[model samples]
Target: MDLANLHFQNPEAFFLLLLGPLLILDWWWHAHKRKSTIKFPALAIAKKAAKGSKVRARYIVPALRMAALCCFVVALARPQNATEVEYTSTDGVDIMLALDVSGSMGTLDMLTRTDQAKLGVMNAEKVLKSGRFWDYSRLGYAKNVMAEFVQKRESDRIGLSVFAGNSYTLVPLTLDYGALLEILQAVDDSSASGNGTAIGDGLMNSLARLEKSDAKSKVVVLLTDGIDNASLVPPLHAAEVAKALGVKVYTIGVGKKSGTFLAFQQNPWTGEISWGEQPIPAENSLDEKTLSQIASSTGGRFYRAESKDDLEKIYSEIDGLEKTEIQTIAYARYQEKFYPWLLVGALLILLELVLANTRFVRIP
Candidate 1:
């Protein structure tokens, strides 16, 4: 017999301990208690009768009871042997990247101010600030950073959203990073005609997109520069909706009112031209307080980005934060062990009864 197969939850085997003392006590009590006395006219007749009959039957009740108890005790310990098995499955993460494409996003924070145009700006500051030129559009910065973030997660399903005065889906939730990047790269400030920021609408759109996902983990990355200005739905209400559906939203506030570069453009085809590069002032200062509250309400974090570098670092951190759905399988296998013990107990009890009534039986 395999020792492992004879497992007991109570390792002390308490039933065995009780049975030993009980059997011994029962045997001793019976031995001293039962006595046969004869009032005989002749002593010789009584002696002759005692020699013909057995003094007492030994070992029947105690032996049978001990055997029965042992079998029953062993059965109480549920035991099973392990068997190896194989398992296979697949799962991934779902993420939505909601970006603000409002016109104010053309704020320029990249490259050192140079030439006579950069004059009056501190020269020592310019000398210290020489860096690579980056496109000065909120959409452009978001596209580049999100591209990098998505590239690192091959197993995750990604989607895109552009929210301005209104919101619209640029890409539905999908695993095709190629298509997502293309849509994100093509995004321009012209996508939104209204000058307002619909931050709440954007979050609501992302939440609606994830409603059917059924993914183990769902997330929304909302990047915006303004408050709930043009949105019909309020940011807090949208967050409550997300909480109801068990989705986490990470909010990124882009652009600061002071010292960030801003670029203007001309529609050459319409012959309408706009001039000058200025520091982009927040139409409404980036709502860090509201954004932080949104993140906190849903077990997420808020990040503030005033420069392209800050945006890049934020994306790297968010990439690290995104988690994949996990799946697990459990099983229970039981072996029927009680029947054998019950059968043995019944037979032992029956044998005890029969020996008491038959072989060792006496006439009244």
Candidate 2:
């Protein structure tokens, strides 16, 4: 709109505008040779456009096309208007999420409902007695909960590291949460199943992601349902590395001990519950002592996610970590202003096309 400040990125493209005059002259010469003269001040020509005869409309189409050509030439020139704007930025922490995918995580003991312990036990019973696999097992439940945790940290750079018998980085630290979530959703669909828990491998792999991160605060959230039975590096050794790197490690032990799956039922009509508890098997633990030490050594707390609610609560606590912030200075930037010209050119060409193909169709 401001002709005084109009800028064209590709000013050389305006040479295309020269074709408009030649096209109009060629059309006029043909019309004059046929003795079909048309006068114009285009405003007057448009006044009679709807009632114009087919012969008269012939001349109008070429002029409409020429006008469209001129508009397009302006668009090709890439006109823009530069304006100044201000912006502010914030510093967000770097995080790595390490999840366990060991065979023990396939146990149908985690809850997807409230009053987790009772519901968790009841749900496990239903899945077992009905002979149907609970697709949302310990790992499944963890993935679902962790997806929500990822969404809450929008400004931060987060990565994911998975471990079963071994550990590897699944996604590197970045701000692209959308792509991260899609990859996370596909973890169970793949055949990357593992048989043992390598907590140290997973933790160390996660720490490696933040090795070069320059953020003021770095953190790792490690969630697992099994003990570290297969790792070359001990979990404590990884914790020491994290402490030295000034990265906090929040360790979470999820699901209950193996062989402790509970059984309880309710009468349909009486609504009375009954317990058929078997003799509790010797506890198969997640080695909570080691997990706690790893967390404490890295200046972070250990959390026990005994049920679905507990798991969600643990993540909620980690989400409350101290956030770092720094002010950004305001600066000037340029914004393109050629969109209107391009849109106008496109609409004019479309109108000319519609008119020629329908109401102005030539018999020849």
| Each prediction's whole-model lDDT (CA) | 0.74, 0.77
Error of 1 at 332 (Å): 24
lDDT per residue, candidate 1, 1-364, as tens digits? 3365553444455456576787788788987797887577999876676533343454566678778777667666543443435343447678888888886664454432342245324343333234211243455667788889988886788898888899988899998889888877777776665768899999999998998888877899999887778898999899999898889999998776566453434566984434335654555578889899999999889999876778899989888777564555645454556667768878987897887677766554
- What's the TM-score of each model vs. the native? 0.56, 0.57
The lDDT of model 2 is 0.77
Candidate 2 ranges with C-alpha deviation above 4 Å: 1-84, 112-135, 189-194, 257-283, 324-364
Worst 10 residues of 1 by lDDT: 125-134
TM-score computed on alpha carbons, candidate 1: 0.56
Highest TM-score scorer: 2
User: Mind sharing the TM-score for model 2?
Assistant: 0.57
RMSD to truth, every model: 13.0, 14.0
